[model samples]
Target: MIVDESIARPIAASEAHTIEADVAIVGAGLAGSLARAVLVRAGYRVVLIDKRTVPPDEFRVEKIGGRQLDLIRQLGFINDLEAVGAPYNRVLNIRDGKVVDISVGQAFGLSYASLVGMARGLLSDPTSFLIDQVTGISCSDDRQQLELASGKRVTSRLVILATGMASPLAYSLGIKRRMLAERHSVSFGFTIARPDNAPFEFDALTAYGERTADGVDYLSLFPIADGMRANLFMFRDPTDPIMRELRRDTKRTLLRLMPGLQRYLGDFDVVGQVQSWVMDLSVVEGHLQPGVVLIGDAFQTNCPAAGTGVSRLLVDVERLCTDHVPRWLETEGMGADKIAQFYSDQGKLAADRHSLDMARFRQALTLNNDARWSARRKLHFLRRMITHRVDRIHPGWVTRVRGALR
Candidate 1:
């Protein structure tokens, strides 16, 4: 069912000037592609449109773990994910050149492109995908229409916008993004390997910032199919000279920022391009409408440092596709009232709220030098270190005590 992009043909090539479907998903990114697969497997006709046949190498969510893994399993895409991602079960957490704890869990590392590719490949019918741009959308309470640049049109009962941040298509529909925090965080992504091509001392590692002034949240190193991948997150100004240094002289500037990395990483060189992204924390307004709904970054944007983007999108996908869409389709119309239900869904609301909350929490924890925050930061790490030591000594004592307390 994995359609090769090289041999993939547009649905328009079949001499069909118009297509009809139960759902039309715009933007074949992670969210749209996954939504299409879910709906298709559920016996709904889905038409997915995107400009690119192949997902370009982009600096986006490059790893999946924690609740994200659980959501993927719940959506039945874990096997597809496992086929494309490299797995790591332990991450050595360190601060100030010392071991704070070891986080044991299942996580996968892969390029965002491969991740999206895997999702798109889950479609049993390759002809459902359209490699073209959406020029216009006309929506009503009963049905919606999409005008593609290829001069073809698609009519569907429901439309899902997964076009991501700064979507001109959403803006054209009068859906505006309200900036909660502009330039909220800066993130760097790249691969690294020792000169001798040897693996690192640990299966995975996380080096926390040594000083609040450094504005570094953490540097996470994990395994990908290509090599060891590194993600450096910071709360500093995107325009700072350090940003330039990190890109130009990655290893040296990285070592200078967190000297402790030298011990664990040893002598390593950054492989391939160093991709950087400055994120803005924002959410959509005026999105409630007939025949349409927004999901993923189209609805809200998340701070990369918070690691909540994937979880939020997965929640959006799960709630809308599995719970909301099926029921909505069975009913008469796709109205603002019906669309409002998804926006008000408790699970979606919580995920959206949690992503923003964690965004602010991470920024404050990294750069807030106020006496109260400083003390709080110290206590946070100290608590983790203590718990890790205790767990190591007594094994299941912490788990048992936590269970009893709960």
Candidate 2:
């Protein structure tokens, strides 16, 4: 099925009542909820369905900033972001017990559950969100139907699958995930606090691996609403004994791995349970079909260390919800031809490519020990050190230079 990207089917308000909504979004994760907000605010009837009324306190993407903030602002949710997230601006990057560089930018920290809840709250009419699991889905060019676990059914002109990885719904529709990298990265998430309940010297910090053999990428510490959140990313086998050691003795294991972190963080204790995730880089196959579109982890999985999950999903939501869905609804049929426009969109394609590229880049940059990579690794940190020195001599000089170039 081939559809012209230039054609936009005229909007017909009378036809919106024929179905439950102009679009039915399945899954209420960050991607799904944001899509619903965009479509509904644009005057389209949208039904957002999910199994859990509240998103679980999962160890998903817990921070947002940089390009992610730019997109969220474009969608008119920057104020909402301020409402729910802890804002921070400085990230001290360190390696081998020495400062490498400092990253200064606007960033926010929050739990995945709270982020999703805030996004879902953006929809004006709360009734549009359905709290039910999708048991089955049937798709066609003209209409799509959803069978819920609670015996409720929904029909819409278009179906947006924002279900995260492990989606039986997408698999049932003949969509399969092509694993780009299996068990590519192992990440640990937990909260930490000073034993005396005192504030740390730095607001946010990142410590890179001193030795490549440790397979450590970096350990990022930042502020969340609960406490100081720490995310440790590594390129190592999940089945390795170190995984158990990290879970049992997080403080000692972390210090042994990145001893430099000790100076910046003075005597802290893990506040709660440690949550770990073994991420597999993957993309959806056989998804450009009629009546359905996949977004977020439903379409692709990202490496946490790469920090591209939120950016990629934001691109998916913006391109599909803001551009493609409205046009598809106007034309009457949700065929592959219409869906292909989104798949071929230059912006979406670039974001997906950058995600995969960064996943491989981070893994190789951390673990690859070839002569070429060895030199590349040295140059990487050396460049950062040089830049830091230059910036120290003239504060905000780097920022001004980059801004002028832009």
Candidate 3:
């Protein structure tokens, strides 16, 4: 594993004026950093560039579990992830003050900055990272060039845009974002602590919204290094008055919206700043160009409420770095024909489609008051509650039945 390599050795300032590599990635976030690590370990000379020296304290994805953890292990970074993140194996799921089901699995919680930092630290050659804004980019089937803000230039055989939701550079290349849904969902992030600074009774907890009128999907509370981190996902309008109230008086607003949470939380106060994001579900058009490729949020945005953002980006990184890029590098040119193979990959296409579908399903389940959806909403919780009860009564019975059906 790359983690066993010596610590990163940064390049001198003088040697960075002109750089060359087989691949030049424009963003050093999780997606870009992971790509650089994978390519470098495969013996490809890769350069990763970002304007910020340190990843900003952003309120992005804060937890990884399930398929996300599987992908991390597949990339050989599970040990590194366990080192930096706080892990929990059980999550008590509840709705309207009653237990729905208990989710048992390995998961980790950490801030976005720390997560990106872990990815960046995987590169033994820190010199491959450039801290300068890209002023312009020009690409062709044979090669690509990038102009930097510090008067440096980077020449490479391929360029990858993992710039997240920002699209200025992609726009310059005639690529545009096509909004599928505007103001599709809103999310809130913050930390909470008990009055006495004591630990909560459960390992982790998820409280689902009791009423459709509240517009809330769920409130997830998990343990980070500092304290319990809270992520509240909603389908409400971003401009609603409740949004302001949630920011100003978080604890009170949360209790009023989901009264069942009070019994579980037991007099907790909101700590630090409350960060919120309004997401517009979108994807890029006209991105199939020579010498350039889009991945992660640079290519598409997902509804945070659905919890599919990390899953989609991890799929993008695994498929591009492991399967597509190597095959493209074996050939002479980085043409659209080669780049098209990645977009058409079965695994990539399935992930992208599943993200969009999950986003729409979460919104309908949370806010739709139609007769059919209402019945489904009830059955959803009821089914889980019944299964949980049966599991307690007959240990391993549910697992045996599910395995037989599969």
TM-score of each model, paired residue for residue: 0.96, 0.94, 0.96
Q: Sort by TM-score, best first.
A: 3, 1, 2
lDDT of 2 by residue, 1-406 (tens): 2333333222333224223667889989899999998887777777888889778889998999999999999989999999999999999999998999989899999999899889989866766787888898999988899888777678878899999998999999999999888999999999999988899998899999989989999999899998899999999999999999999999999999988888889889998999999999888899989989999999999999999999999999999988887677666677899989999999999999999999999999999999999999999999999989998999888889999999
Lowest summed lDDT window (length 10), candidate 3: 1-10
Q: What are the root-mean-square deviations of the candidates from the true structure over C-alphas?
A: 4.1, 4.2, 3.0
lDDT of 3 by residue, 1-406 (tens): 2321222223235366777778899999999999999888877777899999999899998999999999999999999899999999999999999999999999999999999999999966767888889999999999899999989988888999999998799999999999999999999999999889999999999999999999999999999999999999999999999999999999999999999988888978999999999999999999999999999999999999898889999999999999898888876999999999999999999999999999999999999999999999999999999999999999988899999999
lDDT of 1 by residue, 213-282 (tens): 9999999999999999999999999999999999999999999999987888878999899999999988
By summed lDDT, the worst window of 10 consecutive residues in model 2 runs over 6-15
User: Could you tell me which residue pairs clash in candidate 1?
Assistant: none
Q: How many residue pairs collide in each prediction?
A: 0, 0, 0
lDDT of 1 at 113: 94
Compared with the true structure, the alpha-carbon lDDT of candidate 2 equals 0.89
lDDT of 1: 0.91
